[model samples]
Target: MPSTPHRWITTPLTAGLVRGALDLEPTAQGILPHRLPAWARDQNTDGQLAMAESQPSGVRLVFRTRATAVELDTLPTKRIYVGAPPRPQGHYDLIVDGRPAGRAIATGGNTVTIDLGTGALEHGTGPVATLRFAGLSDEDKTVEIWLPHNETTELVALRTDAPVRPADASGRRTWLHHGSSISHGSDAASPTTTWPALAAARGGVELVNLGLAGSALLDPFVARTIRDTPADLISVKIGINLVNADLMRLRAFAPAVHGFLDTIREGHPTAPLLVVSPILCPIHEDTPGPTAFDFSRLGDGRLLFTAAGDPADGAEGRLTLNVIRDELERVVARRAANDPNLHHLDGRDLYGEADHRELPLPDRLHPDAATHRRMGERFAAHAFASEGGPFAEAEG
Candidate 1:
């Protein structure tokens, strides 16, 4: 550790470049990062939306410094279900000179406990925690700290042996992706290891992840957000959130999708826009959902999810993965006649029956870390390879 107190610089946390989040709100103790702007947030007061948007999945702190040692102070908000095992600490990934360097974990943070049956929430306060990394090369370099994807991180302070400045943008094409919890980094080992982050690295693009866990409900506000954000490439992963929530039937889903695409096109008329359907989830493959928490395993300290709707309910406009896939394909095909930039990809191509056999989803919902890696690699190859793929540079 550096001994000279006079040499240490306390850089304001707001000085670092924060990406992926749409807004940063100043709080009494620190700065709170939010995925949705204040306007969008005010539109809904649902706890689900509040929690999902506050977890900055792809947000990172990017700066340039010659410091060999650095420390960050943060207050993270972690959630725990009453009957489930305690959740793990949040992870912060560090990158130096565009390469993976090291990772650290935040030890103390506030905890929010929830009773699923009663819908009651209890909050507990915890002290802020410090994350420190040392032994970095003395030479000037760019540093990136990927914030915990599943935790609501409040930035308290940033200290380093040397002064810090925001790093220059890489000038890579920005790929804006919007999806559900799967895209929000659930079950992924770390923030940067999330499928979207991995795919961004492989595709050599900047990622603006608008993945709101359990909140990809085809809201007009979300479509407007996408329509207003600047981007070179855009993709929306549809269906899973809808099916699992059982929010809407086929009749409403089709028009909602069309409206969503129409809104996006108003801003990005020529950008390569890819529409991806849900990947195969065996439980939801033929069966409809409003997936329910499986409490059978809770006695053993294991929390699991199970499909709760009947497969035969499709006759009443219920949605299944199969039903969603067919409708998405038809919608894209019909719209593509006039919009050459629009394209569609079946989620099965990313993770199909064969892949599922080798790598199963732990919760029967979100993919595990290894599966996330596979999906990222496949997505890069399918959409970003030089072989006239949907996201080819030629389109630009």
Candidate 2:
């Protein structure tokens, strides 16, 4: 008798297997997941937000199968900064049965070259890359393939030695989070290790990360998106992007924050809604932003940022970390009096001045991998692990 040939089954990458995205766009080559729905995407025109939402930070392909071998074809948008050393390749993290199993990277895909100094751009395309994982346990198990947190990826195809189906529901609460680059896994070791991801795992909750890089500017559309989304627990990390982008003055910031929270309350009237202020960033602690790249570091191929706005500008309502924090606390306090579920978490508690002394932010903006871990652990303790904490009831 002839030996049986190895068998492989290919499946369409549909919304059934994708999580953490609000919409799925069909492409000729594959499916592109977007954190923002088509309607919200249409309401926005900012290229930065569009790019950030396109990156599937906390999104993952989750399914149940006994396949000992699996492969994923992806077209990733890789970035190359002119005159700078290439950044490390983004990682795809694998988890089995709620635990980390393995990791891999897709090699070829699209590349975008950007010149920071002149603001020039160029693009190139490469063959879709296939990432594979072998020697998995043959036992029926839930498999989760986490997309790269920092790269925009399109799912081209999935192949496994055995057929796959939707994973059994874990019966975990869904945690919806929105924040800036730090929460977007800017310098995280991998997709699954981002602070929000880690916190969700430890809290035993499903995560929907809307950490839209530099785009968390308290947009009404974003607030509307959050309002429409369904979640057991919701958190919005504000302040960092507002300061760093110098998007609005204090007068405008307060109403924006209020309106954002009000919109969410409209849809989730009784959900445990947590408002988080910006973490301790010494560079912008007191100084107003419009953060500018410290191009001086470019000589050594290092990227760093510095505050561009004058400190004295605060008298004119220029927003800073401290200013934002005070306003957020006030807003939550007033609302919590009548709305019992409303809560606030100072981002400093997650990554504060003490943390900065030991593990300074390498880029002066985003936390590094270790800080990510620390923030995640601290956040879990305060939000989910602590007695009578915001999400503790759900956790219990």
Candidate 3:
């Protein structure tokens, strides 16, 4: 065992800025991050909702330290889908002085096993584990520990070889983004690698992500949350979750969008608000969904989702990606004529047919890590570039 340093400082976890999480509450074990606040979470009792809200998709611990070594204690609940391949271990992405430093995985927490055959869940709790990083430069620098995007983690403690302080704001524009699983980092490599996070880094902006997996159903509560939050730039990525859940028809989706935007506008009446439609998801482009898990591939240790709705259902108002894109374009165009602060970006521009050929979405529903990187880079160029961009004039 390595000898312990003679002196160390323990900082309260709350001392570090935690972005992207809507709520933080004390748990029996530690402080748990919630993408949705307790009141919002209380409105839904579904297991999927519970799991998704607790995952802390874009939450990160950011502080300034001169420590040569640091340690974080966390109790993570790792989920296991029975009959499928084991998930990769949850990881914390470490960023030092605005650059990727390394990654660390905490071991021995809790395991949640789900049986597909019976729809039963078995949870086993374990002890908290430490993730230690050593050999740092020992110079005062900003340190960001991006929480695991997939696992439900409860932060236990933060310890360092030297004192730490909250990091100073970089005076960059704050980008507040809301969307579905793709934005929530579905299959991205790590929390910092998620498309939104990547775009933030590329654009030199601070990010407050409101992407919620299996939960971006254009809910009014979410809209109000975004409206209330402080942001210099705002974006709402819509469509996929509604289609996959078969939540509503076109008649409802359009009005729901209007209402959602209305709520956001109530708080951010003049902030540059960008409306983004769904990307080119071939399976859901023309076909409506009620996406289903492809069990045939599950036997091969792969979990894939396929659209189950009929293409002919369009006449019945079934929502599809194409329909969503058209509606979003119309909505943004109609409103933009009167509201110069509002803008629209075709999701296809971010991940379209051309990009799909080179870097495909591995699960057919979410972009892989590499695809995420591409999308981020493209979004930065299109939205944050100096000339002919919506944000160009606003920067000054």
| Clash count of each predicted structure | 0, 0, 0
lDDT string, candidate 3, 1-396, tens digits? 124846667788773467777789998877999877777777775687688879988789888889988888899999888887788888899999889998999799999999867889999989998888889998899999999989999998888999888887767788899998888888889989999999889888888888888888888778888888888899999999999999999889888899999999999999989999998898999999999887778667778889999999999999999999999999999889889989999999999999889987777888888988888888888888888776654544
Question: Residue 275 lDDT in model 3?
Answer: 93
Instruction: Please identify which of the two predictions, 1 or 2, would achieve the higher lDDT against the true structure.
Output: 2
lDDT, candidates in the order shown: 0.89, 0.91, 0.87
What ranking of all candidate models by lDDT puts the best one first? 2, 1, 3
lDDT of 2 by residue, 46-156 (tens): 877988999999999999999998888899999888877677789999999988889998898999898988878899999899888889999999999999988889999
Between which residue pairs do clashes occur in model 2? none
Residue 202 local lDDT, model 2 = 90
In lDDT terms, how accurate is model 3? 0.87
In angstroms, the error of model 3 at 355 is: 1.8
Q: Report the lDDT of model 1 for residue 135.
A: 93
Candidate 1 lDDT by residue in tens digits, 1-396: 235557689887773468777889998888999888889888886799799989989999989999999888899998988877776667999999879999998877898999988989999999998888889999999999999999999999888998799988767899999999989988889999999999999998888888889988898888888999889999999999898899999999899999999999999998999999999899999889898888887778777889999988999999999999999999999999999989999999999999999998877898999999999999999999898788878746
